[model samples]
Target: MVARQFIVRHDDDDHHIEHDTDDGFEVLQSQIFSLTLVPPDQQKILANVNDAAINADSDLAAVSDRLVLVSVQDQREISISDEELARLLQAEEEAVYLQQFQASGNRREFENRVRTYVPQVFLYEDPMRQEAARKTVPVDEIEEKSLIFLAKETSGHQTMKKAMPSYWSYSLGSKNLSGGTSGMGMGVPLPSEIQYGGSRVELYWCNKCSKETRFPRYNDPIKLLETRRGRCGEWANCFTLYCRTFGYSSRLILDFTDHVWTECYSHLLGRWMHLDPCEGEYDKPLLYEKGWNKKLNYVIAISKEGVYDVTKRYTRNWHKVIRRRNITTEADISAVLSDITSECRRSFSREITSTLKIRDERETEELETNVHIPVGDSLSLPGRQSGSKEWRMARAELGSSDQNNSEQRHKDEYVDSHVTRIHAAFSHLTSRISKEGVKAIKKLLEDLRASPFRERTAVLESQGIPHLGDLLEAISLKGSVRPDGRVSVGLAGDPVLTSLALPVALDVVEKIINKGGNSD
Candidate 1:
């Protein structure tokens, strides 16, 4: 049998034509043919096809036979013109550009833009044109054979079995209930009302501890299942396998942040629904079940349509849990869990109050020791007396001292008494301010400042004051009382003394003004 092969090239297409004959096939009209030559001393054998002869023959089959009988020994060569070559190159470039644009979602528009350029961009070489002139077998026969081979190779694998009706049962072993133990415990059953015609298989692997495991096919069940060992990613993979094994389309979806879950297409719903077995069953309230909650940390679900629906329910619940844990200063799991309860807000508020009380007490003691007050002969009353038992004893003996020292003792007693009264007043003011508003306390301070010095001193002495320095320090530290009852540096643009000194200064100023600005 003789066979003839022609290589044809167009601007953007290249194909081969083959003809079979009894004798060596002949090209009826020659354009270009392959030849072999020996060394310079030897003859060269050339093969050529006569295109005119083939065209002249009315019967193509008879012409093919005759051409195969004739042999011409000559090397045929055909070169493409520079312009044609440029055109071919241009066509190739355009094809690549159009393909890229199409891939980027501009297929129709790109094709329209290139349509006018296509004709000018493609040019056929002489050899290619001559090849195109020949006739050969139909193209469909070649395509048919190729498809047959592909089918043979692909269809050789064993088809997986259909899912069993019993497999749809929620039972693990004999248990009727769902979601308790692995294997023996009833697995979470697909809702019976929801018709699913796919295979089902369970998978298991630890995301954190075990090597990542991927099931070879959807139909294969996971070899092991352990509740505490695996994370959400592993659980998702298992569920996906179950659906795939049953011949239902399933996929393990992971978010950008490595959050893993399973998406199963429900034939009934005609949509993909996500399931998070590892996160546990959805709670009763949609917000509590799917919303941002502290116990679950971060949770977000994305639909196939590319919508991001992050549940703030989980987040809100988590925030409350953290706040409760922090306020109670309880680092235990129980405390953390308790905070997630409905009364979490009230519980945390109580904790905050307790902490504030402790802070206030410490602040009061510090203020009392830090204040300084001048005594007789430039001596500072309560000078380092905070740690002195001797000073306390001397002060305590003031009433029992001899008559000679009585005047001096009286002076000391008076200073002590005055300081005590100031301390008491400041303490009372703070208490009232805390209970009432700062505005009420500020008005009281204004009235005290307008009172006579003798009257204020008499009240202080009657109160049996002690530690004037402590009183001054407390008043100075507390600063001014704002209208809101907060102790601030300034109030209504006026600077007020510490809780201790506000009354004393107001009384002294009032007395001096009343006495026509006379010095004490």
Candidate 2:
């Protein structure tokens, strides 16, 4: 028997133990007992697939996989700090993510899946066939219960005037129920399951239609041309095919956060331009992040040409989005994508493929560059413009209409509170940090705060995101924020405070104090 690794979580931390014992999973419990002093009955061991037993090596898969042994005792819950619990949750998420990552990277299941589920499958054939379909939409005869119609109707706020279905239990509000569980692949769609296995069933209400209304859930995008009704998925699918049929090299993009859009390669600009058919939006990759306020993770673009991970193109907050990308190492994902792209282009001539490879490299560079460089000026991007106002708000994709107003109010309050903190820190630092004339630096900041907005704007620009205490060290020396909240030094980290040597952390403060750098 091959030895397996187990994370024996006892008190403060986790202990990894190896076991060659066979027979049943009780052997794992026994091994855990030897270390944690927890009895066999009290130990709860969980795996990625089965929490109950591991009869073979096949059950143990993926790099992040490990057995989590939880002790069932009185103090178990109480002893865990919020940080430790969060860490354990992240570990569990990584394990589940790795399982899917390996499965997605498998050449066999992947190619078949790509053929079936990837947006590239929705192709353009005869223009006449597309025209005919566009001209006609047959009444779709669906099975009585096959369709799940979900909705949120409101007079103003989200409230249920009429009682919903008694058996309809939803993870969120009044969505007409289709059952899902808490187990892997069985449960309600979770944050961690984005890239691996997914299915789309747009939940929208039909006005003046009965539950028995027979509408066909057409898989083919050509059929969507005539019907012309769908959520983001259908809209993007239909539009992508239309673009291709019209002689544009188009791709369909699937956002793992339950949205879909189109991308068309522009010969004029020699780049793929973002097109959200639903939003009537064009060329704005950061629209979802800046406008709809969508916290996106995985956004894969697929066409007849190739598959691409285009998530970075759609975000400026790559730092936060990175934590959700635990499906696999980026290198493994690139490997899988490269293989898939090769297979996709196998039919093309060597010259054509070479041209494609160059284009791919250029696009890759463009997307990576976009990760750091931000767009948009003083006026923020518009909110989600496609869905119903209520629906958009429910999705929290309503962007910065009323949100900007509320945020401004909150920001004013935050700035007022933060100014007091900055003043204290500045005072403390002025006493300790004597480099570059601390008095002058202090007076400079004080002038900036009391100065008019135009004068402050003349001096500093918006810099990095701000936080006060612990994070202050991270921002300090590297950047500065005007106490009035108008400007931030180091707009994209050029270091506007380079001339002044200021105390950032406790250690720096201690060193300065001990050196007697203060001019008292």
Candidate 3:
């Protein structure tokens, strides 16, 4: 059986109504008839229907007023469930939301919001359950049904409709082909693999310079070629439009620092390559190799995964310095390069550490001044005084010889243990803050600090330190060694020196050890 569906909207009430007919239907505005037919007579009837309709209705309005009459010999049927229809509607809604989010530059926020709501919205909607109830048909059966419907609708006559090919077909071979029967011309040259093409245009705009920019040739032709100078964003957009006009897939990537570039998918290369047209001349390559060094390796490092890989490359380069130094194995340059790199990374991390340190200092000052105490158990004046005494006792409990050790030892040890970790964490944290802002980092830090293990574990993990449990076990097993070369039995399990005070005291010792080590 054949069916026709059309939508009518009333301007008076802005209401849309859909009308469906089983027989032949005439489109008023287009003066087109859709007809269904019986086996032997179907083709003959449809072939003459268009001419008959045109003769019967002198105008488009008269053609639209004509009633559609359809004849059916078979009773085969197909049905769609309400649940399936709902799911289809939901998918469409989600697609629209995603499109709007991307267009508004809120793609990330939209993803976050959707993630936050997905569970609540889809808690009862199970794909497996829906599929279990869904009807299934063989591929041939579906194809046969579709063909039958087409034959019935056309009344054996070919339908007159505009032909539009798929995007892939257009990109591959849509040009140079003859009308309707021909395909897009294949072998259209792809966009040039030049980096900073868009960026160059942007830079030119900033510098108030004007120049012609070239893009990869694709079948689709660009409209509105820009002549005046524009920024990197403008240039990148223009380049993207040109590529799109040629049926080439292109993207514009803008960085937090206002760095803009263009990327296009190269079908021949089977990879998306970077193009920075703004950085160098239009004809220059994207990345250039100078001996073993790769220059202008511009990539969008947007996530921890991306940054981690990039860092690994830098770390590997540092390792190469060891072999290239041409010194004894004992004088490996790996440590030197690592130290320099670590220092640079630490410099960046310091900003985060400094901010956190300021917060910590403020909290400490508030605690000292007894400024509002956090909500929890209340401490009486006597209890507070006793707590202070306990803190003093904890410090005084340390051995005289331990306190008398070289002051530099404490600084060196603390610095060694904490500085590298602090630097790395600080760097990661700063990067997060730079991309997502301070509020995100602050919330993350707050969550981490609330956890029993604290975010310090992240620092330890990065430094390849043993797990906290193992460290605690080690501290428990080897707590204190006396000057007499004997293990202090009670001290091993002492809460004061072994567990409570040791980690804090070690921080000081670490600073001293590092200071002395650096001096040597």
TM-score (all chains, Cα) for each model: 0.16, 0.43, 0.17
lDDT of each: 0.32, 0.53, 0.29
Compared with the true structure, the alpha-carbon lDDT of candidate 3 equals 0.29
Q: Predict model 1's lDDT versus the native.
A: 0.32
Runs off by more than 4 Å, candidate 3: 1-227, 280-520
Q: Write candidate 1's Cα lDDT for 1-520 as tens digits.
A: 5465544332233334465543232332212131211111122112225443333224444443322212332222224467755664565455444444333343343223323222211211123322332122222333333333333333211111111111122222223222333322222324331122112333334333443222211211222222112334444544444444444544444332234555544333222344444443212112222222113322323221122213222222322322222212222222322322223224346776574345334333322221111112222122111112453354342222223343564685456454566656655434322222333334445644454321221112112123333433544432443455443322221122232356554554344344444222
For candidate 3, lDDT tens digit of each residue in 1-520?
3233322222222212233332223222222211111122111111123534332224322233223333322232224456755564465455444444334343344233223322221211334322321222132333333343343343211110100111112111123322223212223232341222221111111112222223232111121132222334334444444334334544444332234445554433222344543432121121221111222221222111011101111111222222221222211222332333343345446676564345334323422222111212221111111112344245332222323333544575456433454344333323322222333323333332333321121112111122323333433322233465432222234322232223333443344334442221
Query: Against the correct fold, how does model 1 do in TM-score?
Result: 0.16
Ranked by TM-score, the better of candidates 1 and 2 is 2
> Which scores better on lDDT, 1 or 2?
2
Give per-residue CA lDDT, model 2, range 1-520, as digits (tens): 5555656545756778776545335455556666665555455566634565333343433323455566654222244457855665576466545645544444443345444545434355556645654444221211111111111111110111111111211122123323321211222333332322223322333333322112233456655554554557666766666666546787878777888888887543446778776665566788888878899877888887878889989986665675665545565667777777777788999999987887888788767655655344553667886645677789998876645744664675445333345446655644543443433343344444343322232233333322322233332432344677644432122222211112223334444545755653
- The clash number for model 1 is 44
Q: How many clashes (backbone N, Cα, C below 3 Å) per candidate?
A: 44, 1, 51
Candidates, ranked, TM-score: 2, 3, 1
Weakest ten-residue segment in model 2 by summed lDDT = 156-165
Error of 1 at 79 (Å): 78
Best TM-score among the predictions, by candidate number: 2
